[model samples]
Target: MANFEEYKNIWVYTEQRGGRLMPVALELLGEGYRLSRERGEGAKVCAVLVGSEIGYLAEELYAYGADMVYQMDHPLLKNYTTDGYTKVMTDAIKAYKPEIVLFGATHIGRDLAPRIAARLDTGLTADCTRLDINTGNYMKYLTDYTTASSSGLEANDGNKGLKQTRPAFGGNLMATIVTPNTRPQMATVRPGVMEKRERETGASGQLVKVKVELCQSDIQVEVLDVVKEAKELVSLTDADIICSGGRGLGNAEGFELIRRFADKVGGVVGASRAAVDSGWIDQSHQVGQTGTTVKPKIYFACGISGAIQHLAGMQTSDIIVAINKDPEAPMMQLADYAICGDLKKVIPELIQQWDEEEQQ
Candidate 1:
């Protein structure tokens, strides 16, 4: 095994598009700071930026707790392509060694991280919900053990690796993974799972500019133009409050009550997989293992059964209110506030109360 001491610093892939930083990048940088802080001054939190004319984002990274920013700026690299990004990022990692690299579990990140990992011959944990540094928990298990039968491995520093924890087995359970033998521990974290750190006033990080050797031949794909998506699209991850309905809603028309309640509460409508499959609502509003993950300030589970898959998506909400007639349902049990009653009657009653309160 190579000397782990040679690998230094924690790096976050600061993903951007059209010169705008993604929210997940800042979220990961905040987590990187937390992981590096306990390791003392030697382990620095660095942001690996790859885009054209995005050098100005260095200060933003610094403000969010990045100690250093590595900017690989080029006109050809403005738009993200799997071939172009993976090549430059893999090259950068080889030049500047990082013990752990964090990437957001976004569309681009999902495509890029795996390729980079394969090129470098490293393991990657994808869509991780949590990340932390090891702190002597595994040392006790290895204390009585000696040499490995296969690789003849011995414990040097058991508490010094990055702890990558993620949902596994169709989101039924969570598994924690550690790459003790790998040079750079890599993981793709889900967006909205980690909280963003507050920016510091007048704080700045060290900027390191990197130049990549590239040509038109190197990029297999070319960007002719960029088409922007609708600005008013419903994003559960970005919403403050989400009112979700499941099979408990009874039928497609059940969603009408949910929509009314959601509108009254100033929240967006979300759907369970059952609701979506039954054609009650669009898949865009589905929340589960196969659906979008969300961590809203408040979540209302209207007729939503708390399946492990569904819980995995929205359990992180700060406040969960479950409305179901069955008190024994998992959703009701996990909720901060559980209303054991018929939603048909309860929903209208609540709306009526809201109307009265508004009149007062």
Candidate 2:
């Protein structure tokens, strides 16, 4: 019953809003490039842009490594509501079949990827941190009859596994999965996790524009008015510097000190999970397995206990500075520079020094 006769290439769901491409689109393009190369075969990394007059953005995808661009320019697709996007994308997938599909783990992606996979009856590995090809499993998906047998993606070749890796077990471990039996092995990768390819001017790829079927009844939500978030979007991902404090601060008032230090340094204030879970700070300020992953130019850990969950999020920061009274603390050991002094004293002095330098 599956249309095994159709489809080729890898697909990254190009989510466009306000005429700008999100960073996750670029990240997937980077990974797709490497995965295509590993196969030692030419596989088009396609960008599926579904919306109104979004064809102009298709060429930009090619600069980021897309070999082909599929555009579904429709009037009903002007704005994104779950129902509308899923409809158009599903239609496109049924038209031009792809091997692997990637989506950003942001709000829209988290909402869309699973639904699309369910409708197509395909296996999807969500929130992947890494991706690679495995030839050993290519034949396995074909012979291995399971949930993956439903999607019409089969090559009469040997096994080539697509490995997707992500952090698991509360960030205590990492897990790698292979889609040995599914067509368009889908995944939702975290934002800011992968590097974006360099965009080039005048780079072009093949374009296929398709008209999709749509009805007003298909749209579930009606647009009232659009609202924008506050001017400062709290870009923890792009933060140049961060100041984090944890349970060592011990109480709510302690964060005032941390906030002051952060304010002086023109940095965002971050907190360990313990501090956040204990209700000392806001959820957005928490850093760790359940928090935002950051790679700031400088990250300061103050009065914090370094649990692996907390470290998992900020470990990848460019430079880590820590101040813990207990010199033997795990965070202190991992810090690029560790201070074994009381934060109550250290913080004030540092602020004073920065002030003096500013005045001079």
Candidate 3:
């Protein structure tokens, strides 16, 4: 068994592409900072930055709550390779021994986190929506967010281990997992799930340059070139307003109206899983637990009944406007503004009013 006591700080994998830090990396740092404060033994929030010539990105990590940064720069690591990144990340974990390790649950993160966990013989909880270091906070989260009953829930005030909570069994249940035996408890959090702390301009931190030991023999596949896809997709995470359609739209053609409304409001188009599964829209537009988690400023759910799975993704939006015929629908209850009517008629009227207001 590993000595859990030797672990010190919390480590976040600050993932970047094209020399730009992913928003999820900043989100994790904010969470790591909170966890460090909760752990309360001089536990710092550190960022692990890996790539070639990316040493300059460390300062931004510091500005966003990273107390220290581990820079692993190498030519071979410019593009993400499972073998190259996994080896360096695993080596770093073994050397530094962090108490907690976090990764964003993006395509690359999902691929990379599991490999490092397997290599280190540690446990990793993937797609975690909530993370807590305090037992009371964990239980409170379960009470507020999950359907779990308090009848059997026992609270241990002394437990400071990371408690990772995620949706389970096709979104029907939530499970809280803990790795008490592991030195560094690891988890991959979905994007837009955690809130980012405000950046402190000119903030500085301790920087550690990690020596990269890699060769061609370690990697099986060589990335000759990266071709960006020409398809245009809306960035739902960055959108301030989102106009989404669901199965109640009745047909794929319903998305056309959703698109028009989205265009009018300068918002992006989003869809419930039902609409995407029914071929109403591309999977890229899907917004839900199994899809992308979003927290837009305004989320308009048109013709959606608001199932729990759908709510899990967008419930955190700043304001929700639900339009459905059923006043008793779950979305109506949760919505800040609930409109009971046919979305076909309601949306067009809303568009007309918005246009009239603009004209005046």
Query: Which candidate wins on TM-score?
Result: 3
The sequence of per-residue lDDT tens digits that candidate 2 reaches over residues 249-312 is 9898999998899899999988888898889988788777778878899999998878988887
lDDT of each: 0.85, 0.81, 0.91
Which digits, one per residue and each the tens of the lDDT, describe model 1 over residues 1-360? 657778899999999999999999999999999888855548999999998889888888999989999999888898998888888899899888898999999989999999999988888999998775644433433343323131333344546777677878767587778886777889999887887899897798788998787777888987888898565467788889998999998898999998898889888899888889999888888887778899889999999888888888888789999999899999999999999999999999987898899999
- Cα lDDT tens digits for candidate 3, 1-360: 787789899999999997899999999999999999999989999999999999999989999999999999999899999999999999999999999999999999999999999998899999998898887777787678667765665576588888898877656467889998877899999998788899999999999999889997898778888787865677998899999999889999999999999999999999999999999899999888888888989999998898788888888899999999999999999999999999999999988899999999
Steric clash count of candidate 3: 0
Task: List clashing residue pairs in candidate 2.
Answer: 99-184, 134-160, 134-161, 135-159, 135-160, 138-159, 138-160, 139-159, 141-180, 141-181
User: What number of clashing residue pairs does each candidate have, in the order they appear?
Assistant: 0, 10, 0
Best first by lDDT, ranked: 3, 1, 2
By TM-score rank, best first, the candidates go: 3, 1, 2
| Poorest 10 consecutive residues by lDDT, candidate 3 | 148-157
User: CA lDDT of 254 in candidate 2?
Assistant: 93
Where in model 1 is the C-alpha error above 4 Å?
136-158, 358-360
List of clashing residue pairs for candidate 1: none
Better candidate number, 1 or 3, judged by lDDT: 3
